[model samples]
Target: MKKDKEKVLDEVWTEDRVREFLASEPKAGTDADFHALLKAYQSMRADDFELFIGMFLETNRNLNATDKAGRTVLSYAKEHRNSGEHVAALEAKGAL
Candidate 1:
């Protein structure tokens, strides 16, 4: 059991893994997908979050997706504490 836990922790998130995870998700360009990404972004560390975003873009996921209220990932990052790196990453991707 301990070894299983350790192995799980040792697992690295790959581009294929990211893509697989998104496969069952709502359409890539949908608001639901954007919201899902936002939730993941809020939970991840800056580096991992950046990688996720890169994978998202590589899969042709929406970069400038917005919520029903028109709130975007950038706007959420700006509102989040210690999210400067996240904001920068999103901005570098032309998120608005």
Candidate 2:
């Protein structure tokens, strides 16, 4: 489970809050699209992440974007046993 120092259960996720993630940029050589997707996956719960994906797609972002290591967000989620919902969200979006 993700352990946050001050985790807020049942926290509200407004559209603006979720949309803010889209503005995230990566380091010089990192893929910007991939970075945004990865950040959202790491920061959001599966449901919110799914909502973020819809907004991401509306902006024409690449769902299959890979990191320098050639690992997509789905790859990272797959490595975690607790990521069933997250994996389902990625697959629903047709991520490779």
Candidate 3:
């Protein structure tokens, strides 16, 4: 089966655009910080995720925020098959 949408690998991400992910809000009862981190991880490349982490910490956001299920971004990243670099980035920032 052919997919209708094509994947974009080298999409340009500027600082402003990368910083925008910091404002991502979560659904009710979900952790805001976790949602932001997950969204940034899902959207940005590894380098951009690393850059976002810096800005996230500068704003005093929680790097260890957990979802309703108590799963941190690091926990989720560990489960993802392609998230090795993302996991490393999260760990370097001391995310639990």
Candidate 4:
């Protein structure tokens, strides 16, 4: 039970906010915008990284590949203490 609770904590997510933000995109723009969205989403839920990681990986070929916003995955994660898992997920997806 303790381990289960810890895993849930490591999961890190404020689901409602993250979902709403992701759903509110313009649908077409520079990869920078997409990166920003992913950055923001990951910041919210380090554990619930599926949405952002999947978004990037699914469109890997189309992704910006560079964070023009001058932010790195770890840098963004620094803003959200709960985002450790999210940072890991983004790294797995190849977000620089």
| Model 1, C-alpha of 62: deviation from truth (Å) | 0.7
lDDT of 1 by residue, 1-96 (tens): 355444344446665555454544555555766765776676566677787787788778887778777878788889977899989888888887
lDDT of 3 by residue, 35-89 (tens): 9998998888899999999999999999999988888989988998999999999
TM-score of 4: 0.44
Q: What's the C-alpha lDDT at position 60 in model 1?
A: 81
Stretches of candidate 1 off by over 4 Å are 1-30
Clashing pairs in 1: none
Per-residue CA lDDT of candidate 2, range 1-96, in tens? 976688578888998999999999899999999999999999899899999999999999999999999989999999999999999999998999
lDDT of 2 at 72: 93
Clashing pairs in 3: none
Instruction: Find the 10 residues in a row with the least total lDDT in model 3.
Output: 67-76
lDDT of 3 at 25: 77
Clashes of each: 0, 0, 0, 2
Could you list the CA RMSD of all candidates, in the order they appear? 4.5, 4.1, 2.2, 8.6
Clashing pairs in 2: none
Candidate 1 to truth, TM = 0.69
| Best-first order by lDDT | 2, 3, 1, 4
Per-residue lDDT over 41-83 for candidate 4, one digit per residue giving the tens place of the 0 to 100 score: 6455544555655654554432234355655545566587666
Error of model 3, residue 32, in angstroms: 0.9
